[model samples]
Target: MPKRIPLQRRGRAKPKFRPRTHKSLGKIELPKQENTGIILDLLHDNIKSAPIMKVRFGKDVMLLAATNGSRVGENIMIHKLADLPEGSLVCNVESRPGAGPKLIRSAGGAGRIVGKEGKLTSVLLPSKEIKKIHSECRAIVGRVAGAGMTEKPMLKAGAGFYAMKAKGIIWPRVRATKKNAVDHPFGGGGKTLGKKKTVSRHASPGRKVGSISARRTGKRRGKK
Candidate 1:
């Protein structure tokens, strides 16, 4: 009899696979109105690689991504895209006007404002994608702090395991071909699957292992 695949089990929403979010301070949200805030403290959240800042803006207190050179008692300005000049670096940018920040919140990440056309502002993301955002969208005016956090090697498998556990991600993933035939679709083969792995986007759970709904498969050939 075939056993349930890892993908199927993960889809079942078991507690072991669920992310642990109880330790999170709160969502990194921007205020509706642009306001200057003072960083009261810097703290770490288990699920995040970047340090978080507790800031007070008037009577309202909120958590925000810690920017490079952020320090306690330091005042920071949160501004809209229209207010920032071109070539400025920003993080935690809102995806839409008044929607709050939704991009570039990763540690050491920042998006550069490259150009503007009418009401749309062009932001160059770290992935090299140029996204057009509304000029009214707000963003923090700095790069996320804790650069080079991933540059250091864990040095041990145990260290890697704990790090993944904090984010509730399964570590040391076993290849499908490495599993037994009854356990995985690509199993029973040696190192190679000996078959095309692409499947339809609407394939059944047990048959949805690899390259689902791919536009094309195999190595690309260049024109001579």
Candidate 2:
């Protein structure tokens, strides 16, 4: 009969492993929403005032509200909030949003919609002027707000308050300044290096405690 051999235990059993998944990492995805409410209001107001509008050149018009009624190839006015009636066309606009109007053809600045006619949309720009825009170019309704001014800055006070609580650090008053040498070297004032006195010359042994000597190592044995 063969001798019964004992099973030798090898290394400790490995723990069951799980591959990391993005779901476990706690990342979240958010859906984008259309920001057209203001545009819709402007269009509704425009249509209510005048269903049929004509755009001319050399006339100054103010956009009273935002809108979406005007299309490419259609004439429109730059009616101001103060003066809605008696608009001009000699200095008016001529191009629509979808139609490829030349940048030089814009009477006003880029993104400005003109409301007059017969006036040359393109101007003889000075040599210093780098941009070439068309006067006839009309921007889509609700598209004329200046850069980033329409959107509100996100409120971070709530998150910041919670973070400060967790870190056990009080939010200091806005005007408070640091006291004395505890501040970093780049900090203000003649408080440079503060009350701590400089070390005297040849105080400690060379390369010993607190010395600025170069590092040296003893010769190794039998390595020549």
Which candidate achieves the best TM-score against the true structure? 1
Superposed by TM-score, candidate 1 places the C-alpha of residue 99 at a distance from the truth, in angstroms, of 1.0
Candidate 1 accuracy as lDDT: 0.90
lDDT of each: 0.90, 0.27
Off by over 4 Å in 2: 1-132, 136-138, 142-186, 190-224
Clash count of each predicted structure: 0, 38
63, model 2: CA deviation in Å? 22
Off by over 4 Å in 1: 195-204, 211-216, 219-224
lDDT of 2 by residue, 89-136 (tens): 122222342232222212122222233334323322222232223433
Supply the TM-score for candidate 2: 0.18
* Candidate 1, 36-102: lDDT as tens digits: 9889999999898899999898888888889999999999898889989999999989999878778
- Local error of candidate 2 at residue 105 (angstroms): 19
